[model samples]
Target: MPLEFEKPILELEKRIQELKETARTTGVDLEAEIRLLEERLARLKREIYGNLTPWQRVQLARAPGRPTTLDVLEKAFQDFLELHGDRAFADDPAIVGGLAYLEGQKVVVVGHQKGRDTKENLQRNFGMPHPEGYRKAMRLMDLADRFGYPFLSFIDTPGAYPGVSAEERGQAWVIAQSIQRMGRLRVPAVAVILGEGGSGGALAIGVANRVLILENAWYSVISPESCAAILWRDAKEAPKAAEALKLTAQDLLRFKVVDAIIPEPEGGAHKDPERAIQNIKEALLKTLEELKGLSPEALYQDRYRRFRALGVYQD
Candidate 1:
């Protein structure tokens, strides 16, 4: 079912579909009717999406149909040879990475992978990475640095796994180390927030020379529900928390937390994934081109400077 705000658009679409079906069955000309309805649908989509609230955008980011890391990899890259395991503990399905070719340029691609259904979600731990996941990502980053392959990361995690077993495995230390290693990475790196970029789990792979975000994606220190619970003692206040957090891509762009905003399709990325992936491909190529000539020292310095410049200060 469509969200409350999207009901009108969906209803119009349903009517258009019905008219097309009737035309097919009865030989009556419904072209004029369908055309009018299509125009209305376009306008309605623009008007609704243009004025979406932060909370609404958050919902869209978490939409089940939104493209996942694997989805983007299949569409946007080629020859993905998936590498796994932390070489210490077991392999975590939440984070997937390996060597891939982007527009014929060999690069290391890593990202959080969320499952599409209940069983798969359980396997992915709802995209909450564990210690092994972070370690595996760090390993891939190191490999990319060693081979001089530009690192590309897609961040979409709720947070690091908070389960007892994950903590026992030193999840916090793994996350911290991943962040530290990323900070000093010798090769050019780019991270795109495809969906929910939450807390250290997201940041563990997010330190990049160029950080891009999808139009409806979010990057935040904490999830809105968690923040709401901490601030208002109730999770139902999440909408308010989302508004206050300034976590939307647009907000982060204005704050200079992100390098660029990759535009999504009319309703969202899920509506037109091919177009969304194409937009991401264009953005990544542009970023890689911009960073192509930089030396290793320059890459590190650029990344350091980018993160260092991420706060408000008054002269």
Candidate 2:
């Protein structure tokens, strides 16, 4: 079911689908009706999506049908060879990465992977990576740097795994190491926030020369629910916390936290994932082109300067 705000759009879409079915079954001329309904659907979608609240946008980012890292790979890349394991502990399914070809250019692709169903989600650890995942990512990133392959990362994790076993495996240390390694990576790297980007888990793979975000994605130091619990003593105040956090793409763009925003389809990315994937492909190509000319030292320096320039304040 669509969210409350999207009911009108979905209703109109349903009507259009019904009209098509009727036309097919009864041989009635419903072209005019279908056309009118589609126009109204388009307008309704634009009006609703364009005016979404931060909390509403957060919901959309977490929508079940939203494209995942594996989906993006299947749609936008070619010859993907998934590399596994950290060569230390076990292979973590929450983080997936390997060599892939993007528009014929060889690149290293890495991202958080959340599953589409309950069983898969459990297998993926709800996309909350453990220490092994971060280490595996760092290993692939180092390989990319060594082989002169552009590194592309898709971030969509709730946070690092907080379970006792993850902590026992030095989760914090591995996350810190990933961040440190990414900061010094000599190759061109780009990261896109496909959905939720929470805390150090997201940042571990997010230190890129270019950071892009989907229109409805949210990136924050903490989840709104968690922040609300900490500040207001109740998780029910999450909507208010979301408003105050400025985690939306537009807000982050204005604050210079993101490099670009790739606009989603009318309702959201989940509603039209193929279009969203196409938009992302275009953005990646353009960004890669822009970064192709820089020397390794220049790439490192530019990435450093980009992060350094964030959080300017006037008091």
Clashes of each: 0, 0
Q: TM-score for every candidate vs. truth? A: 0.95, 0.93
- Model 1 stretches with alpha carbons more than 4 Å out: 23-33
- In model 2, the worst 10-residue window by lDDT is 1-10
User: Which residue pairs in candidate 2 have backbone atoms (N, alpha carbon, C) closer than 3 angstroms, thus clashing?
Assistant: none
Report lDDT (CA) for all predictions.
Answer: 0.93, 0.94
The C-alpha stretches of model 2 lying farther than 4 A from their native spots are 15-39
Q: Which TM-score value belongs to model 2?
A: 0.93
Residue-by-residue lDDT tens digits, candidate 1, 240-302:
999999999989999989989999998889888899999999999999999999999999999
Per-residue lDDT over 68-119 for candidate 2, one digit per residue giving the tens place of the 0 to 100 score: 9999999999999999999998999999999999989999999999998889
| RMSD (Å) per prediction | 1.5, 2.0
Clashing pairs in model 1, backbone N/Cα/C closer than 3 A: none
> In angstroms, how far off is 264's CA in candidate 1?
0.5
